[model samples]
Target chain A: MRIALDAMGGDFAPDAIVKGAIMAAREIDEATSLLLIGKEDVVNSLLKEYGYTGNKIAVVNATQVIEMGEHPTKALTHKTDSSIAIGFGLLKMQQADAFCSAGNTGAMLVGAMFSVKAIEGILRPSIANFVPKLKGGYGVILDVGANAECKPEVLEQFGELGSIYAKYVLGIDNPKVGLMNLGEEEGKGTVVVQAAYQRLKANGNINFIGNIEGRDLFNDKADVIVCDGYTGNIILKMAESLYDVLHEKGISDPFFDKFNYEAEGGSPILGVNGNVVIGHGVSSPTAVKNMVLQAQKMVSSKIWERFKKNYNE
Target chain B: MRIALDAMGGDFAPDAIVKGAIMAAREIDEATSLLLIGKEDVVNSLLKEYGYTGNKIAVVNATQVIEMGEHPTKALTHKTDSSIAIGFGLLKMQQADAFCSAGNTGAMLVGAMFSVKAIEGILRPSIANFVPKLKGGYGVILDVGANAECKPEVLEQFGELGSIYAKYVLGIDNPKVGLMNLGEEEGKGTVVVQAAYQRLKANGNINFIGNIEGRDLFNDKADVIVCDGYTGNIILKMAESLYDVLHEKGISDPFFDKFNYEAEGGSPILGVNGNVVIGHGVSSPTAVKNMVLQAQKMVSSKIWERFKKNYNE
Candidate 1:
């Protein structure tokens, strides 16, 4: 298996990216290869400084870099030689089994949709974030800012997609899927949420657990929580801020420690044809390493194949 | 000024409610009175048990009590003598300067809408929650579960309402109003949010600060944040959950302490024709006292009259 890493992406670019790629290369089996995509000299010099001369690693030069503030679609279309664009190019051509980047998130999503494209029969691709639940468990929440305005049908699909992800990637059996709503009652949400709740209940593929509210986020109420991207994104950012508050106040605890973005690495774009993961723009070396490993897990599980089979069946 | 306290409402009922009213009455001027609305005999007994009877306090008989789980609209209509219903009745009859309840939130909202009714030209009544900021400051967030689904026009009104609240009540001069969105860009949100952003920007009545994301909730990016009730409700509950996690983990800090519900007392229903404050259902005596004091401040500020003038202007 070949994993492509956008070495020029993230706040800690070539230095942290190269170190993380080397760390991941050492941990993966001999069968797996790591391709560092960035300015050839920059990545190579960092790799050489770390004395990382392993046969399992190679560097692919990309001339341009997409800055964090650049317009996503515009950057992808204009900067053809950028690391993000080239990484997606490699994934589309089957030269890489998966692509991982801690780069401009919008750029990554754009590349996934326009480059390798969405999986067949998928309405739209969604991103999933790992939520650390209480009592030493985790849950998956989907569409975390992918499609801010989703139709009821799209939301229902998020339930199925998130369920599959929890079951296959996270190894939760028959994952309980819950629609994130304002209240626990069936009719207790916006028009979209109410319609989606009905459809999700009728979806045979998922274990519909009815409505779950915001307070249920950190608990063991459900294995998979699904909401429109607008709501999901807000929760994701709010959780991040809470973590920030805890950290700033010098408060230390095991559960909150898990809220660290580095622990989850990156959020995977679930409905795309190929494996793609987008990490935080300010990823450190540890975050980048975990992001690579997350991508590896997705590839090993044959997530796309399962999604295709699930949809077909 | 006479403030009506729902002595039969909240988890701590007549005891805490009556004590809080007594505390408020003693703190206010001699002309102010506390009208305890509940089982008159029970409330009077509690007041008597606390100390010698004072002329500053009186009791109004309300035989029926609305349970927390009862349907809001149904209970308000059926339980005419319930503390919540009678509280509104007193407000409507000009017998009370303000009404405060720490019970059946839905019932309070229903009573406020049906009794005093919405202010003229107000699209809908909204509830505002005070968000504790990091640097010893606070921000006002609105529509926290009042209207689950809001149109663009209604959201724009929230900005104006929240701005007025921050300026008059919180003492923030020309508070910067921000429309909560998935992204900071003008067009980066759900269709409704994007439309609201445009209208908020065009609205000269408030200091519009474009868009604010979820992470900005506890930050100083905007003094008043506005969103549809659905999103606002989710964030509010999520913030509450974060506070719960911190408390459970024994991570005590001054910043986290501010997350306590008792600090802010209650959420005030804005855009209503009268001053109405709703506290937590499980509020302790301290929280009840704060809620009463909050209502006192609203009445003293003549918030409703100011709102009417602003809308007219």
Candidate 2:
């Protein structure tokens, strides 16, 4: 399996990315290789400075660099030779098994849509983040910031997308999908949520486990939490902050430590044509390494193939 | 000042409420009194059993009771002599300075609307919960579960209502109000939130800070967080569960300890004709005690009067 990484993404771009590749090289199996995409000389020099002498790693050149703050559509359109653009080009052409970026989140999302594209029957592709469950393992939460205002059908689709990712990528057996809402009642929540509840319950493709409140995010009630991007984004950020608060206070339990973004790795773009993950913009070397490992799992599970089978077949 | 509490409300009912009243009696000043409204004989016996000889607490008769699962509107109308109804009646007739309950949340909200009523010009009354800040003190978040779907104008009004509550009741001067969104950018979030941003910024009544994200809940970015009840309820429950998770793990910190609902007391109803608070259905004696004191603070601050003054004449 080959995982193509954007060498010029995130706050600490080429340096951290190169360092991360060095770390991941030792961990990945001999069959898996890292294709580091960036300005060739800069990346090569950084790799040399990092003292990376491994057969599992290689560098690919993309002359231009897309800054973290650039607009997604415009940047991807104009900067065709940028690392992000080139990374997608590699994935679209099937040259790389999977692609990962910690760069502009918007650009990563836009590139996935334009290149690998959404699954044929999929209404909209979603960004799925991991929620650290108290009992053990992580639950998948979708549309973290993809579609802020999702229609009922879009939300229902998230349930399906999240479930497939959970069962395959995360290894949850028959993942229970729950709609995020204020209340647990069948008729409770906003119009969109209420409608989505009925649709989820009626849908036979996923294990629909009624409505789960915000309090249920960390519980074992659901392995796949479905919601509009607005609610999911807020919950994801809040959980991330909890980890920060605990770490700052010098308090770290194994379960609470899992709340760390680095612990869960990067959030994946589900329902796209390929395995793609978007790491935090401030991703550390460890976080990047974890993200690479996460991509390896996505590739090994053949998640996009499963999504295609589920939705397209 | 006279504060009326529903003794027959909450899961523990007359026992916890009566015990809570006795606890409040010792903490309350000579100027403040608690009118425990419930089955007169039951409440009086429980108060005596608890060995309360304080003159601060007195029993008031409420023959009927509103069960926790009953529909709010029907329960209020059919059970006219219910503890919640009688408590609201006392507030409406100016016989009590405030009313509070841990019974069916919907019943409390409905009774507030029918009895004391929403302030003349207020679009909707909101239930405001306290968020424990990392620095110190608490920030007020409004519309927790009152109005699940709020318009841009209603959200703008929440900014005003929350600012008033934060300033007067919580004793924060020049409270910073923020619209909760997926991103800190101006155009981020759902359509309603986008529209609310413009209105909150334009409305000179509030100290409108720009949008704050989920991570800012405990930060000093905004002292009063404004969002629709759907969003607020989810955030409130999620925060409460954080306290639950931490407590179960036997981890306690001054800041995280404040996440306990008992520490924050109860959610107060804002932008109403009179001060009203709704406690958790499974409220413990300590939670009920804190709730009574919260009612005392509301009465002392005269929050409803300020709401009326701001929204009405």
Per lDDT, the best of the predicted structures is 2
Model 1: how far residue B61 lies from native, Å:
0.7
Candidate 1 residue-wise lDDT, B1-313, digit = tens: 9989898888888788888777777666767788889998888888889993678878889999999889999998899989999999999999998999989999999999999999999999898998888877789999888899999999999998998889889889989998887788879988888889889988878899899888898888899999888888888888788778888877777777777888778999999889999988888778887888888889988999889887777
C-alpha TM-score for every candidate: 0.97, 0.99
- How many angstroms is residue B123 displaced in model 2 relative to the true structure, after the best TM-score fit? 0.4
In the order shown, the candidates' Cα RMSDs to the true structure are 1.6, 0.9
Chain A only: list TM-scores of all candidates.
0.97, 0.99
Model 1 chain B poorest 10 in a row by lDDT:
B23-32
Tell me the tens digit of each residue's lDDT in model 2 across B1-313.
Answer: 9999999999999888888888889898789999999999999889888899879888899999999999999999899999999999899999999898999999999899998888899998899999988889999998898888999999999999889888988899999998899999999988899999999999988899999999999999999999888889999999899889999999999999998889856899988899898999888889999998998898888888988888656
Candidate 2 ranges beyond 4 A from true positions: none
Per-residue lDDT of A222-299 in model 2, one digit per residue for the tens? 999998999899999998998899999999899989989998568999989999999999998999999999999999
Question: Per-residue lDDT for A175 in model 2?
Answer: 96
Q: lDDT of all predictions, in order shown?
A: 0.89, 0.91
State the interface C-alpha RMSD of candidate 1: 0.8
Interface RMSD (Å) of candidate 2: 0.7
What stretches of model 1 exceed 4 Å from their correct place? Answer: B22-31, B50-55
Compute the lDDT of residue A64 as modeled in candidate 1: 100
